[model samples]
Target: MSAKFEVYLDHSGQHRFRLKAANGEIIAVGEGYTTKSACLQGIESVKANAAGASVVETDD
Candidate 1:
């Protein structure tokens, strides 16, 4: 049981994706895209760039 990405259409019929943890909790969500391919590409981008991504606190 590992984290996985699930792609699907949103209520507005736009493509979106959610990253779910092993326990099935959604950990992250991607923005809506007009095409599924684009949505998948977004997932790939996250996979490619997230490993070394820096975490910084923002004052909000």
Candidate 2:
């Protein structure tokens, strides 16, 4: 099966988001939102940091 990722903001308008797969499996969860711009920048940082990284999938 293939998985899709998503992003969201917390109730407090904080970027305390969670990155999960289409199957609802959590990949990563974090909180770092002092500002909206900073939150977006943090997302970019996560993607950049993941570039060329290996993705390990385990069978359920």
Candidate 3:
């Protein structure tokens, strides 16, 4: 009923932020950030712009 947030580090150690559905399928892969905080900010920004989505991190 609500969106979820997930975060991970890429092969380059950068942050990878993604939004997905509850079914474990990706909805959107946001631009990579140089820092975790930056990625988190991106997630927040995405969530503010969307709804009923989940965020996740993926390997590079």
Candidate 2 local lDDT, 1-60, one digit each (tens) = 455334566777776556777777988876758676776677678778888789899998
Which residue pairs does candidate 2 place in steric collision?
none
Writing each residue's lDDT as its tens digit, candidate 1 over 1-60 gives 999999999999999999999999999999999999999999999999999999999999
Top-down TM-score ranking:
1, 3, 2
In candidate 2, stretches whose alpha carbon ends up further than 4 angstroms from where it belongs are 1-13, 53-60
Please tell me which predicted candidate would have the highest TM-score against the true structure: 1
In model 3, which runs have C-alpha deviations exceeding 4 angstroms? 1-3, 51-60
Worst 10 residues of 3 by lDDT: 1-10
Better of 1 and 3 by lDDT: 1
- For model 1, what is the C-alpha lDDT against the true structure? 0.99
Which is the leading candidate under lDDT? Answer: 1
- Backbone collisions counted per model: 0, 0, 2
Reference-based TM-score, model 3: 0.69
> Cα RMSD (Å) between model 3 and the true structure?
8.4
